[model samples]
Target chain A: MNPLAEIVAITAVCVLSGCLGSLLGLGGGTFVVPILTLAFGLDMRLAIGASVISVVAGSAAASPRYLDEGFANLRVAVALEVATVSGAIAGALLAGHLSTRALYTVFGVVLAVSAVQMLRHRQDRDGLAVPDDPIADALSLHGTGTGTTVRDIRPYRVTRTATGLTMMTAAGAISGLLGIGSGAMKVPAMDLAMRLPIKVSTATSNLMIGVTGAASAVVYLQRGDVVPLLAGAVALGTVVGARIGSRLLAVVPAGALRVIFLVVLLIVSVQMLLRGLA
Target chain B: MKAAPGAPEAGARQVALVLRIGGGLGAALVLAGLAVSFAESGGGWLHGSGVDPLGGDATMRLSDLIGGLRHGRAGAIVLLGAIVLAATPAAGVVTAGYTWLRARRAWLAGVAVVVLLLLVLAATLGATE
Candidate 1:
């Protein structure tokens, strides 16, 4: 494809993915990578490099809004960053040694799993009204209060911090290997295992994912896997797309948004699987 | 509850202009650095020693040192741009958080965040490549 045309196509995919990802509280990179690799026929390593750039862009574009809204708990995010950053470094290092074929197969499976989870967890119900543990209190896992639009911010406690950290480490490893944001796993682990409310988990995950991507991105940079032209294009596209997606949240109905999210996940999952098998 | 109207509007316009100039300059510097390195690497003729404008790398026995500088410069420029890009989202969260803390104009802040995110996404995507 012509360079300009390729950019335009990738930008379209980035915008669509960001819009749905934001709505579903999933990181846009999850969707962006599959599309770039499968649909565009880009190499997995290159796709990963490009995906990291997009993740950084999307996270940066979305972070301010979440922080402004008091939805992001900086203290909680910072604490989690320790785990995420460490995990990211490990994962990134591992990625360099993995075979491309193995990476694609694993990525395809992860995508399918993510799609199922999104489909299964359709309703946005408030979690346990109050956190009931020491870990939650120490980490400030509880929500302050609910918003007018989203309802009351429910406080959640970490039932098993070790478990959550382990999952995060695994997620980080996958992120490095595949170049996906791994937010799909992080948010759920935080929300369900750590017992954080959905919104808090989502925002906090967004904050941490960037650090994870950064750790892994450095590995790619050293390996010369990241093409400057491709990274630049994807990053530029994702930032703009994430901005639009964030804005559209207000007007779009939450239910409809969830459906869109599921559809995108399903499509991307299939695409990845096909690409891997091919 | 309207702003002393014109004053707020003027301030808003000023902020917009600042953001525009900041974003444009940032993108330009990033692109230029990348182009220069691409040139020096013999990656292509448009940016190589044959037509080298940035002489540091393209024409030097100290080519390794110049190459290192180019790589470092490109990395720094890209990192800064990424941070600036990420700030838009952080700003939204901050704005919303502040409004919630203040207990006023919460909806306005929410709407602003959504708008800002979309605008950033559109502009970034549109400008790709």
Candidate 2:
């Protein structure tokens, strides 16, 4: 492809994927990697390296703003990082030696499962109403109402610490292995297993994915899995795409956004499977 | 927690808008630079046998892609640097945009940025080989 054409293509993909991901609460990596590898014919390792860079860039960019708005719980995020970072390191090391076929198969399966889960629970938007454990009270993982009187002062507590941590470990491992941000898995786990509010779960997961990506990125760098030129390109595209998507968030309806997300996931899963088989 | 009644909504909107435009432009510049350089290099030079900074085959090693930019055509090096600088902020712009559009979930935006970066890296690096 011509330089201009390639640039436009990548930019379009990134922007669309970012929008869908944000709407559905998924990491763009799940969609981005498959397109690059299957549609664009790039190698899996190279795609993974680029994806990792983009994940860090996106996380860092969005984090401060969220923190400033009190949407992100720094205390909870920092506490979780201890587990995520370590898991990422192990996952990255494993990624270096894993067969591309295996990686794709696993990634495809995960995407399919995640898609089903999203579809099944599409109507459940209510946040946790009651604290299920002492840790949640101590941590103050509660939600305060901004305008509404009926749902004012909703407190979100971590009911299942052990389960949440275990899920995080799995999320971190997937992140390192496939070079995906894995927020899809992490957010849901936190929400369902630990009973965190959707907003808090999303913010906390975002805070932690960067740390996880950083840990694995180092491993990829050492293993010679990361390509600077390619990484640079992906990082650039993701940043631009993410910026566009973030801006459009308010104008889009929640239902429409969710549909877009499901479509993207379906397409990505097929692409990953095809790439792995090829 | 409820915001104190009478918080500055206008100010917050202004800040968000500013962040969006600034971050978008930065990311675009980086992608443009990488696309230009990768095209100019014809994607063949990345695979040509050459000694990289790591003292290994430049084609197979990721380090070579990073460490070997200086050794490439001078124009390519400049483009590479521009791409890296621009791409970082682009990530922020993309994330913010996503947050505005969908769940307003900050992490999803972060994930978007990271994934885009990885795609760029893979394309540019893999093309070299």
Candidate 3:
């Protein structure tokens, strides 16, 4: 492929990936990696590296909009990040030693289970219940979501801080090992376990993914897996795509968002299972 | 309990500002690098066999980056941009933690500090390995 054509193709692909990523509060890497490697015939390591960078770029670009719209819970993000970062470190260290096939199977099963739980807990009313976790209470993890109008403002209390944090560690570890955002894991944990609204879960997940992606990104950088021209094209695409996605998120109804999340979840779950089995 | 009026908004605005700066600069540098590469290559930027310009390892060091910059290597400029982009989230975290501290949200601030430390530890461990 010609240089201009290749760059344009990558940017275009990443634009769609970034849009979906921001909309789903994912890092956009899950889509970017396979597309870059399979379609463009790029190196796997370089694709992962560029995908990681795209994740960071998408997260950073979309988060401000989420924050402005009051969907991203800062307190929640800060609290859970500790576990995610720790898990990422451990996962990075454990990377080469473990069989990725086994890891994929485990992650796939986890995603399937979480998808079921998320479906079972589709009722968003749980957000209004008094949270039982003292840690969450003390940290002020509860917040009001400003979805569309004054009527759309829903105040929510966070529950099961321990469970959520535990899941976050797993999410981060997966992120480190796979060089993906692990938002599929995170959204379920937050929505089902922590009882956050789906929008809140998605937005908060967006806020934390950049930090999580960064944990492993530096290693990729030092390893020289990151090719500048490709990564640059990807980063540019994500910035634009994430901007468009964030704007859309502000108006998308919570029910629609939940449905979108679940569909994406099942697709990712199936993909993971297929990879593991293959 | 309701948050102080505009406190969250204020902090959010500040963090958003930082994000905009970082993302904007990173994107700009990337664009500039691509343009420079195209110009330098005289529009046949994809030429040459046995070397994938968009793939392979380009292990960069501080001094190497400096030298590359002096010689107008587009790869160096783009790499620098990517590094800056990678660092942006950490900077955003610091800003968030600082804002929390300023608001006297001690627990939130503490959590932020721990998260930051863990990130640094991950990088350090990754480097060692």
Candidate 4:
């Protein structure tokens, strides 16, 4: 591939992925990795490497904005980090050993699962729901998330603390293993299971994904899977795209977009699965 | 149990600051590096250029990648960017960890410490191995 063309291709991929990721409140790595592998024809490991950096870049671009707006729950994110970090390290180490076929299969399965979860997500009822769990009480997870343009400061309680942590552990492992930020898993665990607002879940997931990627990034770097130029293109593209997506969030309805991305992901996953089997 | 009125905001700001700086710097360095590669080497970046991204060379180490940034090679700059990109999250861990520790939140601090250590260990092992 011509270096310029490669850069252009990757940058374009990240931009699209980043924009959609931010708009849907999902991180870019999920989309970026598959696109890098199936469409761009990068090796699975290489794609994973670039995906991690792009994930970090996307998170960096959006975390501050989300945090300032009071969407991410810091305490919840912190507590959950325990599971993700540990799981991520293990997953990172594991990815090094897994065959390319295994990675593709895993990636396909993950994307399919995530797409389904996204489809099933329903906006929680609007109310002042106080958390009844002791852990929530201890951590003070009940609080108000300052709204974006379309919403207001919504007060809510986080429940099923143990479940959230456990699910996050799985999400982290998947992230490290596949090199995709497990925002798909994190959002559902928080929004559906723990019963937090989707906005808060997504924001916190965005922040946590960076840390999760960092955990695996070390392994990828050490293992020499993260190609500098490729990762660079992804990082730059995702950062730029995420910024644009965040701004567009106020007016764009993401529900329909989510359906479209899910379909795209499903098709890509099938191709990826065939590629893996081949 | 509510936190102080401004505490969460302050903490969020601090974390946000770390992310913005790390990400922005990383992006700038990477872009600058690509430009320099083109300028000095004549479309070097547009072809099979930028240091080989594979192999066990010690030069690829994080510390060395940062060290190379002083010489102004585009590849080094990109590597430095990657390092910076990777480090942003670690910085977040430290910021959150230290803050929670000061507040006597042992669990949060402990989680942060463990994560930070793992990252350092990954970098260290990658460097040595």
How should the candidates be ordered by lDDT, best one leading?
A: 3, 4, 1, 2
lDDT of 4 by residue, A1-278 (tens): 76577778789878989988876667898888888777767778888887887888888888877776566787788778778877888788888889999999888888888878867758545664545888877766676763433445556678899998899889989999988888889888888888876667777888888888888888787776766767887888999998887666556766778778889878877877887778
Give the clashing pairs for model 3.
none
Proportion of true inter-chain contacts also present in candidate 1? 0.04
Candidate 3 TM-score over all chains jointly: 0.87
- CA lDDT of A64 in candidate 4? 75
Enumerate the candidates' DockQ scores in order: 0.07, 0.10, 0.45, 0.37
DockQ result, candidate 1: 0.07
Higher-DockQ candidate of 1 and 3? 3
Looking at model 1, what is the TM-score of chain A? 0.88
i-RMS, each model, one decimal: 13.0, 10.7, 4.7, 5.8
Give model 2's docking category. incorrect
lDDT of 2 by residue, A164-240 (tens): 76777788888888888788888787777766656556655655565566666555654655544455556666655
What are the per-residue Cα lDDT tens digits for candidate 1 across A1-278? 54445655776778777655554556677877777777777777777876865675666555545545555555455445445656665666677677777777788799778767666753453443533566545544444523324544343345566677778878877776787778888888877777666666776676566556655555555455555546655676676766666566445566676677668667777766776678
Candidate 3 lDDT over residue span A143-203, tens digit each: 8774334245767788999999999999998887767788978988888788877778888
lDDT digits (tens) for residues B1-129 of candidate 1? 110101111112332233344434434544564455445443333322243212122211111224645667453445445434434333433433354335554443443344344334323422231
Give the best candidate by TM-score: 4
**C-alpha displacement of B63 in model 1, angstroms?**
13
Off by over 4 Å in 2: A122-132, A137-154, A274-278, B1-129
TM-score of each: 0.70, 0.70, 0.87, 0.88
Each model's fnat?
Answer: 0.04, 0.08, 0.53, 0.47
Ranking by DockQ: 3, 4, 2, 1
